[model samples]
Target: MNEILDEMNGHEFKFIYKTELFNEILAMIEKKKISMENAILLLKCIGYYATLKGIWVSDFERSLLKERFEKMIKNEVKKKEKMNENLLIDL
Candidate 1:
């Protein structure tokens, strides 16, 4: 019983730690301290860890993350295109 309790406690601690790490990553992204590419990499690592831990993520949650990543990539592409257009106009 004690061993089981200890194991549960450890799992709880890991869950909390992972949650905090996720929040920190979001804060860094909001502050522009990390690039979108790096953020995606970090998120992938987080997801991998969660998967290895057998933490079940709902399909909706997965879809939301996917949508967010796609949106960020699209926005970055748009920004680059706009910059290129501006350069062409200037030329």
Candidate 2:
């Protein structure tokens, strides 16, 4: 996965929704098997990987990608807040 992400500069990134890889990434984030920072890094790079190289992505894929990643970020923040609350309660 790191290799894929590292090589992202040359990737087409034309169809972010083309495979189940996105779902696997989200699952890794949810399971805390991957770092939140890395997830955010991937999300940030998606557009640059396409836009910088002039790759035309479809509207459907763009919208879906935006919606899903935004949702995952929000959920992560909420979960972190809840966990912090529990820690405070213990204190």
Candidate 3:
């Protein structure tokens, strides 16, 4: 994930981390290769990078990563919202 910290937008990183990283991450989550807690930790780490280098990192490659993140986070939010609603009903 040092790549994530690098505030560059080269095509090399585009392939290495942009196109491939999220797929590997999502696959690991799906396959239970990573725990949900760990996934959140990873996301928070990325979020930290983003906080520091939002404008610097958000070039072509970062936009591609954004598209994927938008979709994934939307779906995860829906699931969490549903779970929260259920818990409130139980309460």
Per-model TM-score on C-alpha atoms? 0.43, 0.47, 0.47
TM-score of predicted structure 1: 0.43
**Model 3: clashing residue pairs?**
none
Candidate 1 wrong stretches, greater than 4 Å: 1-14, 17-21, 57-91
Please identify which of the two predictions, 1 or 2, would achieve the higher lDDT against the true structure: 2
TM-score of 3: 0.47
lDDT of 2 at 40: 59
RMSD of each: 10.4, 7.8, 7.2
> What lDDT score goes with residue 88 in model 1?
29
**Model 1 clashing-pair count:** 0
Q: What tens digits encode model 1's per-residue C-alpha lDDT throughout 1-91?
A: 3343235443563554444465566667778999656766655554555565676534324343445545655665688845544322321
lDDT of 2: 0.55
Sort order, TM-score high to low: 2, 3, 1
**Whose TM-score is higher: candidate 1's or candidate 3's?**
3
